[model samples]
Target: MNLLSDSRCGSEEEVRCLLVLPDINILSHSGVSHTVFWLLGIPGLEDQHMWISIPFFISYVIALLGNSLIIFVILTKQSLHGPMYLFLCMLAGADIVLSTSTVPQMLAVFWVHVAEISLDRCITQLFFNYSTFISESGILLVMAFDRYIAICYPLRYSSILTNSLIGKIGVAIFLRSYGTIIPIILLLKRLTFCKSNILTNATCKYIVLAPVSCDDIRINIWYGFFVLMSTVVLDIVLILHAVFRIPSQDVRHKALNTCGSHVYVIILFYGPGIFTTHTQRFEHHIAPHIHILLSNVCVPIPISEAIKTQALLS
Candidate 1:
C-alpha cells in the first residue's frame, strides 16, 4: 500500500493509518486465515495501464451518460409510457448499475494502482455486479417478448402488456436476478479462502474469486453455468419463434425496425462475454492480460449510440 500520510505531524508511524490505497485483501477457499484481497490490472500490459484506461474510462462515461439519457427521456415523456419504452428504461437502469459496479474498481487499479479490497467489500461488489448483469439479460428477454407481442398479436399487445404487467415484470426480474445470487453467496460462506489472495482480474467476480478457494465449489460453478445457459438459450429460442411467426414482409420490416438496434446491443453485450469464457478456458495459450482487459470493459460501448441511430433513421 502506498502512503499518503500527513507530514505536518512529523511522525511517520502516526500518519501510517491514513493509507489511501484499498485494504488489499482477496478471500480464498477453506484452510488459512484471510482478509484483504488484492486486484491486478492487465498483467503483461501493466506499463500501458494509462493507455488501457483511456478507452475503458471513455466507455464507462458514455454508458453512464447514454443510459441516463434513456431513462430521462422515457420518464419525462408521457408519450413514451408504452411497454417497449418502459422496458428500455429498465434496461438502461440495469446497464448503468452494471457498468458502475465494475468500472470504478478497474480504473482504481489501472490509474492509481489501488487494488486493496476486503472480503466483505469484495463479496458486495460481486453480488451487485452479477445481479445487475443477469437482470439486464432478463430485461432484454422481456423486451424481446414485447416485440413478439407487438408483431404477432398486434391487436392484443396493449391489453396483454398493461402498466400493471410491466410493473410485475420489473419486480420479477429484480427478484429473480438477486434470488439467484443470494444462494451462491451463502454457499461461498461455507468455503475458506486458503489459497492465493492475489486476483488476476481487474475486479471482483465469482468466477475469478471462486477458484482461489480451497473447498469444492462444484455446486456454485454448476449453478452459474445453468443460469447462464438457461437465459441465453431461452432468449434465442423465443426470438426465433417470434421471427418465424411474422405474417408478412411488412410485419417483418416493422419487427426489424423496432428491435434491430437492440439485436446489435445484445450481440455487443454477449459477444465479449462468450469470448472471455473461451479466453479463460484457453488461458495457457492466450495472454491472460487480454482477458482481464476485456472483463473490465464489458459494458457494451456503442449500445446507446446505436439506439439513437435507429431513432434518427426512423
Candidate 2:
C-alpha cells in the first residue's frame, strides 16, 4: 500500500490516501487488492502506444461497417424476410450496440493524450455492454432452437416459430440479459472507489472494474460466473445438440456450414470472457486491453460476413 497526500493545500497535515497497484504474480487463484489498477506499472504501459491503439482502431471500424450493412440489408430487402433473417437482424442490432458502447471510448483511451472518464460514464458503459452481450448470447441460443425446429420438424417449423413467438423470444433475451446484470451493478454500487481511477482498457468491464472499489467482490464474481455458465455455456450445448440432431446427411452438412460461422463468432465472443473471470483476482495491464479489443472489435466483421454469405446462399 503506497500512501500519498495532497501537499498543495498549503497545510502542515496533508490529506492522505492509499494507492495499491495490481499484482503481477498471476497465480491460478491469487487474490487481488481491494483497489487494484495495473499488473505492470502504468508508466511502463503508457510507453507502448502502437500495440494499444492501431490494431484496435482498425478492428473497430471493420466491426461498425459490417454490422451496419447487415442491419441495412435486412431492413430494406423484403426477400430476406423470414425467421432466420429476423434473428440476424436482431443479432446485427446487438452487435452494433455492443461495438458502439466500447470502441470509441477505447480508441480515446489508447490514442488521446488526455483521455479521462467519469465514474458515472464508466458504469453506464458497463450497463450497455453487458446488456448487449447478454442479448447477443440469448439471440444465438434462440437461433439454435430455430434451426432445430426447422430441420427436425420442418412441417411445423413455421407454425411453431411464428412472428409473435419470435418477438416474445426477442423480448425475453433483452429482459434476461439486462435483468441478470442489475443485481451485480447494485452490489457494486455499494462499494466505494477511493484510489486510482485510470481505466487501462477501452471499455468498462465488470470483472476488472469490481476490484477497484473498496468492497468484497465475492458476490459479483459468483453471480457473474453463474450467469455466464448458464447463459453462454448452456447455450453452446444447445447449439451443439441442434447441430448433431439433423436427420438428413445433406441437411446435416448444410446445418454445419450455416452454424459454423456462428460457432466461430460465439467462441470469439466468449474468448475474452476467460480473462474477465480472472480479473477480480489479478490485474494485468495488457490483459484487459487484449480482451477488450477481441470482444469489441476483432470478431464482429467475420461473423457479419458469414451471415451475409449464408443469407445469400439460402
Candidate 3:
C-alpha cells in the first residue's frame, strides 16, 4: 500500500496519513494527515559517513563564523555603515538562516544516523531553506543595483539609496521572497506521498519533495517557472546589464574591483543549483544515489560573504 500525508495539520508533528492510489485497488481511511520522511545519506557510502561529515562540519563552521563576523563588524562599526555593507549584512543573515536550516539535519543524519523528519518540521525547514535562498538572490540583485548606482551614478547614489530607501528595499525584497513561498506551501497541503518516505536529499527541498507527491503537480511546476522567470531571470538580466555598463577605463577598473566579489559569489551560489537542476531535468540514466550526492554538491556551498564583505569594506 502507498502512504500519503497532507502537509497541513497544525499542532501535530507526526504524519497521520492515508493510503494513496485507490485505482491500484488499495483501500484505506479517507482523511487528511501528515507524513514522516528520512534522508537516505549516500546509500552505498554508509561506512564513510563519519569521514564525510568532517568536511560538512568544517564548511558549516566557515559559513557560520564568516557570516557572523561580517554581521558583527558591520553592526558594531559605524564606519562601515553604507548601502553596500548593509546589503552584505542582509546577505550574511540569510546565509546564516539557509545554512542553519540545512546543515544541522545533515549533521544529524551523518553523525547519529537519525534521518527521521516530521512533515511539519520538514515543511517548516523547507520554508526557511527556500525563502532564504530566494531572498539571498534578491539581496544580491539589489546589491547589483546598489553597485550600479555607486559606480555609474556616484553623486546621485547617496541621495537615491538613502538609509530609509535601502531599508524599504530590504523589506520589499524580504516580502517578495517570502510571498513567493506561499504558493508552494499551499500546494503542499494538497499533496500526499505515494512513494516511500525515504528521501534522497538530507534537506527537505521543494525540488526534492515535489516529485514524491501523488497529486498532479503541474500547477506547482508552472508557478515555480513563473517565479524563476519573474525574479531570478529578470534579476540576472538586469544585473548583467548593470555590471557591464562601465564608461571609462579607470571607472571600469573601479567597478570590477568593487563588484567582482559580488559577481563571483553569485556564480558560486547559482552554479551548483543550475547544474543540479539540469541534471535532474535532463539526465535519468545516472544512478539515483549518485544523483542525490551530486545534487548536494551545490558547487561546494561555502558561500563566503567574507570575500564580498572585505571587498566592499576595502
Which portions of model 2 show Cα errors greater than 4 Å? 1-45, 48-51, 245-257, 279-304
For 224-301, candidate 3 gives per-residue lDDT tens digits of: 778766766667776766666766778777766666666666667766665565567555576655666655655226
Q: Residue 117 of candidate 3: its Cα lDDT?
A: 85
Which candidate leads in lDDT? 1
**Better TM-score candidate (1, 2):** 1
Give stretches of model 3 more than 4 Å off: 1-34, 245-261, 304-313
Candidate 3 has its poorest 10 consecutive residues by lDDT at 2-11
The model with the greatest TM-score is 1
Q: Candidate 2: RMSD over Cα atoms? A: 7.6
lDDT of each: 0.71, 0.64, 0.71
* TM-score for each model: 0.83, 0.76, 0.82
> Which whole-number lDDT from 0 to 100 does residue 192 have in model 2?
70
Per-residue lDDT over 152-259 for candidate 1, one digit per residue giving the tens place of the 0 to 100 score: 788999899999999999999989888888887887777777786767777887777887888888888777777777665556566656765677978877776665
| TM-score computed on alpha carbons, candidate 1 | 0.83
Residue ranges of candidate 1 with Cα displaced over 4 Å: 1-30, 247-264, 278-284, 300-314
